[model samples]
Target: MLRVLAVDDEKPLLEELLYLLRSDPRVRSAEGASDATGALRRITRALEAGPDGDDGIDVVFLDIHMAGLTGLDIARLLAGFARPPLIVFVTAHEGFAVQAFDLKAVDYVLKPVRPERLAEAVRRACAQLGRATEAPAAAAEGPPGGPPGAVPAVPGPPGVPAAHRPAAEVTAADRTPEQIAVELGGVTRFVAIADIAYVEAQGDYARLHTDGGSHLVRIPLSTLEERWAARGFVRIHRRHLVALARIDELRLDAGTTSVRVGSAELQVSRRHARGLRDVLMRQATG
Candidate 1:
């Protein structure tokens, strides 16, 4: 059972989330907060109590806009913590999705939340938590009665024409064949190995931020990392993988470190902090 903490300024929305979360059997316990400050206090108290106390919160559903401190502000504070709960932003606005994804949120659900959508969000949260907590063997097993790597059949004729093939049948090629082509100024530009600075995951697209400028490339961050990890690009965050040479400065704030690359300030998670520091130190001395 996953423990959830949901925060929203609206009283009615908070009540609805509380009720829906409690109704789900998978949710062991749930809590609600009307503002960011209260939510932070609750989270801090919960964390101090450790994982076994008061049904620890595995995920947080945050609203971007609030009266005092915004959800993004709260998220930044939480990111500085030693162990922060997985965040899922729930807001009426779609504009925050890119920034939310950049912050490595589990999911972004729109406002006027439907029961099905909420349930789906919870399901995804559970899956993400399971991936983080469960053993390797348990995670490898397919869903009940399904074989490993098996694809479900679509309701269509067996001998369908190639042109009339199901949309799902078209295989999306991996971006790491040789070199990826990025479009800038309506022209296709091929980014070489040494010139790329970082690759950031923006929902379905990956933004390639290099020395020249940023370009949107249609590729998954995981794919880019797997292909370029040998070429000096390091995965500093779930959303960001940066080139070691592109790092301009590192700032430390209250034991939390932020790396400066161009105009962007990327956060280094506590779990990855030591490794990043070691890498940067080596770069400095060598």
Candidate 2:
């Protein structure tokens, strides 16, 4: 069951949100806090207690305007932590909507909440969690001959729950579905994930290969492996994680296997050979 914390200076509103959150069977428990200080204390204590010690909180419903340390401040503080709960802004003011999105907030609900809206927000939060958790496996399953970001079209509005409406529509504006930041000649460039062919490891950094050109990033290959592995990248070698579709050919040389990607030939290490073979075999049969 999902756990939640609702923070608002207004007593009645807090109670009302708590009631609505509790109505969902998926929500195991909901805690209410009237101020930012108290909310921080509660969160810190809960974290100290550990996951098994307490039921644990999955999301936070925050009010932007509060007596002290505004909701944005609270969100920033939570963001500083190792693992922060998904934040959903609950506010009467609409002005902060843009700011809320800047923080990548899970959702924003207007004051005097409606039951359906609140329920929808919760569902979206859950769906985001599922997507995050399943990304690596999904990335590993992309067609053997497709680009790394090649995903079966996520069926449209009906396929996604109402809670995910905003996210679903995001691709309309940007063709690339995932977020990517690249650095070139000391200038950082933000590229859409869709444009990337594959990300290659370059020592401490990883180079992002796109239709345009290749750009370098400071993030470790392992980190990218974990993050994009779910999207459609497979580690053919320690230094290479190629987009399955970008693979032009796969040749097994005695006991050694080599995959042809774009203009590069990436060797599959012994450790990854069997897994890569199985993935290719499954894609071929499917």
TM-score of each: 0.45, 0.45
Q: Where does candidate 2 have its weakest 10-residue lDDT segment?
A: 138-147
Over 4 Å off in model 2, which ranges? 50-55, 131-286
Model 2, span 41-86: residue lDDT tens: 9888767765445746788999999997999998888787777788
lDDT of 1: 0.70
- Model 1 C-alpha lDDT per residue in residues 120-237, reported as the tens digit of each score: 6777888876733332342223122222333332233342211123222311211333455543211233556577777888754577777766656545778778777777888888
Query: Which regions of candidate 1 are displaced past 4 Å?
Result: 131-286
Candidate 1: the clashing residue pairs are: none
